[model samples]
Target: MSSRERVLAAVAGIAAVAAAVAAPGAAATGRHQDWDETAYRGQIEVVRSDDGPSDPTVLNGTVFVDRDRDSRHDRNERGVAGVEVSNGREVVTTDRRGRYRLPVYDNMTVFVTQPAGYQVPVDEFNVAQFHYNHLPAGSPELRYGGISPTGPIPDAVNFPLVESSLTDDRRLSCIIAGDLQTYNLTEVEYARKGAIADLARRNDYQGCGSLFVGDVVGDDLSLYDEVKGLSAQTNGPARFLPGNHDLDFDATTAVHSFDTFRAQLAPAYFSYDVGEAHIIALNTVRYPCTPDLDNVDGLRPGCNDPVNRPRYNGHIDETQMEWLRRDLAKVDRDKLIVIAGHIGLLNWADEGSAIHQVDQVREVYELLHGRKAVALAGHSHSIENMRTGDAMQGWRDLFGIDSLPFPHITVGAIAGDWFSGRVTEDGYPTAIQRDGGRPGVLTLDLADSSFQERFTVTGENDRVQTQLGLNTPTYREWYVARSAWNSNPVGAAPELGDPLVVDQADLAGGTWLTTNFFIGGTGSTVTVRLNNHRPRQAVRTQPMRGEDQFVGPEWSDPAAVAEQLVHGGSVANRTMHLWRFELPTDLAPGTHQAHVTATDVHGRRFADTLTFQVVAQR
Candidate 1:
């Protein structure tokens, strides 16, 4: 069957399953559940104590070449020396015999950082199996079954690797997808048709593959298998990180919270090397939230709740910091370091919200020190390409981060707006993100230590970059009316006042052209030309000069608000990357075509056109 047919089949299958299953009420804020809580409660005995293994247990492992493509390490296959291994906290290098030992504790994950010029074994779902969970007593009783109790630490936990030309090549393409937050089987089908199908047809990124930054599922950890099945459709190996929503909130301690996630996916944090970059996937989310005492109210969502209740915040523990330092120490400073995390280090969407930005932003910045680096994260559904030196008042006041030390990007989510919106012709929701970006994935093309990043809208080609529209009084008035209608069930959405026809009065009253550059940021520019007129620079709505965010119709993306407000999704109230141009009042009443060109920070340009008519009066 063709790709479209396959997607439709998957959607139909999921709909059938949804019909057979029952739905549950929404859980905590930002969490959606499909299974009844009482059904799985107390099913598995909670192992709350740390009595399974003594602290600092000796854990040994070997990295060897697999000659036959099998995982087993035979005598014929020799060991590869100098490969790195970690037990979440400590980092070590294999000796000449390819043997490495690290102090492991209960609930620790022992993983190998697949060295350059070699690759690790991948499971049936194409997920890299370079790590082993060492939770001797297993996880606390979780709604979804977590890691089973492993009675004892193994004598040797070997890692098998194969040599491939993909890793050795100087040029590489990597896919980064943020928040595939499928809340239910229906949303799962939405993902299957959207980004998953798009990834299935792509042949690129077979080397570095795809790294899902976080929020693999909404709150239903049970959907991991379905998520993995989607990964199987991709053309390359898949790796994942745990987001706040992926946690088992019932767990008493932070160590056991992500047990289910680890059992199903990869470890919360790990590193791997391919081509010229060292990809460090960091677990920046801290559960049962702990923040600086002074900023606890600002960072923790339920800081005022009962102390026992679970909350989450963005933080990188001291142990992970030490491991990061050791990991970076072994790498060449010139090599590119790609840091992936669930919560962003810094972002424009949550400029004033301390909880969304990493608490240890300065520490991470200092850890990278002299290395070339770029950070990718996805908790906020908006797409932001923050360049170095980008500044805002909140980051400076709360995190003491005066300016971005390096590039930090928030990749748009595959399940944008929590997978809410009207279904499209392709059997998926439009799911326009809050920033007005359509659901998509970001691909980073790397050569040596440098890289250029671009976003691909699901089921669309690379050229579909910017969305254009006219921002007039009529549009703004309709925006408010439509938004109110969406919020209240009583009113009908009046047609968005004519976009193609602009009255002379509206032009004289300061109507302007708007361009929503989804992935645009500092160092990016938008230029517009009207009916063969000279190209004029369009001014960005928000100036990233340590100022507060600008909101409302004047700052919103008209093209995005048009659909978002009518359908069910977040209104496009504000954005950091939208640009606007004033219309010419002297133009005669006639048909006009406006050509818009958006140039990204890396000098890559994308063009889009908008045609509208100038009328004498409405």
Candidate 2:
């Protein structure tokens, strides 16, 4: 209760303020941890501001409504009439000055969708030009993966714009292909002949352009030139991302994984817009092997420059993350965002390997929230049609069926199995599966935000080729009887080049079987039935194996197309010993039937029937 006590209190306050300033995540003037994590509508931010009334909320800057990137708002380049802008969630729009304002958060992205008939500036390789965030201490680096801390929203969020007519056309389309992992020149030729042939012919996709997800080539980087040559055959622009195999093996640092990739294939991580969609291509691989024993190739002491030689794994570094945050901020929530890369966000196989998994996968999901999106990838040479919301915990299980907030598809290989061994009649390898199924490609038809997908094999063209059949009880007995007759081994090697066929059904478990029905006529439908009924009841119903496995679109013979278009007659179905349908349950010892009917895209029908005997139930 005296002058001495008051003086001591003032001095104590000063000491407390100095201590707070010395600590991390703290500001001056002893404002404590009072941070505003709310939404804001500015593009510039200030960190380490002194607390008290002196703490300025907005940074000193100007948000000019430059309808052009020339730093001048021209008459014709006037601001769009009424487009909604946002700070991730809360929305606002520009006034006559073509500007907006809202609350600010620690880290934020403020962007605008260019109104139709107008445009925005693009960077050197044509990436859309925009501005955000001036982080002081540089962006934060990730351990396994992720971007830097956002810090705080900037002061002025200004968007630039331009004008163009192609903004609102109906017939726009984009081609998405994956894993052109060509190991040799021959395999590269196979890719060029098979996949490139289809692209050269499709004029409908000229404007939409094409994106090759990853593995531009096998580990051999020399094949890149050949791959790009093939890509140039298409009538659209080609964009690429590097897969694990596309790394520059000679480099000795963390950034070299994509230096050559970026030199040839645009920005390793970037974004572009086309027809109501925002496409984000991310560079998930972090390169440069370190002294840490956990590195894949392990300590490359011979190569030691971080900039020249990069080492990496499944990851997104600080630089790319900062760009992504700014990029996503510029995009409107309602618009569709297509995240395309070589590695999938969710996969079933090799789930634990850091080499294949994205460490910050969960954090990226949190950033996007529940906006309309789809993720596409190709590293594993398999096709997976996975819906969102599925648990992707392990690698052995197929995560294809689980529902998700967005659909994710892992497209089949361009050179199925490195064009494996010998070339087939189609000028490509017969690349039979180690797992199962022939080669194929995926086709996605997008309408605005909604889209449909179909898998088309290089030689076969049809929406559905799966044939599910039931096993008769007698057939079950035969399946079991065959096992006993196996004096040697159950899986004795069959003749080379013979189609992998199962004649004797294994009653222990029912397995899905498949038949490749390459029908090439109009008015035709391919249907499978038991006996005379279109829907014959089998003792056991099994799905067709490799039914939807397709690697490329149908490479049709123009002569065949012309002939079939007019004549419209049924061709005898070639049974290549592709699949064997199993009869379910125990059928009374007697004769049973198997049949198939084909109805082409033109609506004509063709049918075939075969019969087999049932001994007894297994």
Q: Which candidate leads in lDDT?
A: 1
User: In candidate 2, what are the lDDT values of residues 1-618, reduced to their tens digit?
Assistant: 443343344334433433333211101222112211210112222224334223235432223344324544445545554554444334455566565665554534344444544444443222233434323232233221122343444444456554443334433456677788888867766775566655544444433456777888877765655665565454444667778777766554454445455444545665666666777777776666343522434323422444465545566766566667766876779777888778877543334355565645666777788788888777766555555543333422332322245666666667655566457686877553222234555555456665555555545443433332333322333333433444345564222111122233433344222233332211223445866656532211112121322211111111121222222221111121123344443433556666765443435444555454544332
| Candidate 1 global TM-score | 0.90
Which 10 residues in a row give candidate 1 its minimum summed lDDT?
A: 37-46
Give the per-residue Cα lDDT of candidate 2 at 420. 64
User: CA shift at 125, candidate 1, in angstroms?
Assistant: 0.7
Worst 10 residues of 2 by lDDT: 32-41
Cα lDDT, model 1, residue 468: 91
lDDT of 2: 0.48
Model 1 residue 535 CA deviation in Å:
1.1
TM-score of each: 0.90, 0.56
- Full-model lDDT for every candidate: 0.81, 0.48
Please report the candidate that would top TM-score against the real structure: 1
Q: What TM-score does model 2 achieve against the real structure?
A: 0.56
lDDT tens per residue, model 1, 219-304? 89988877877876665678999999899877766777788999989888999999889999989887766445324545555543
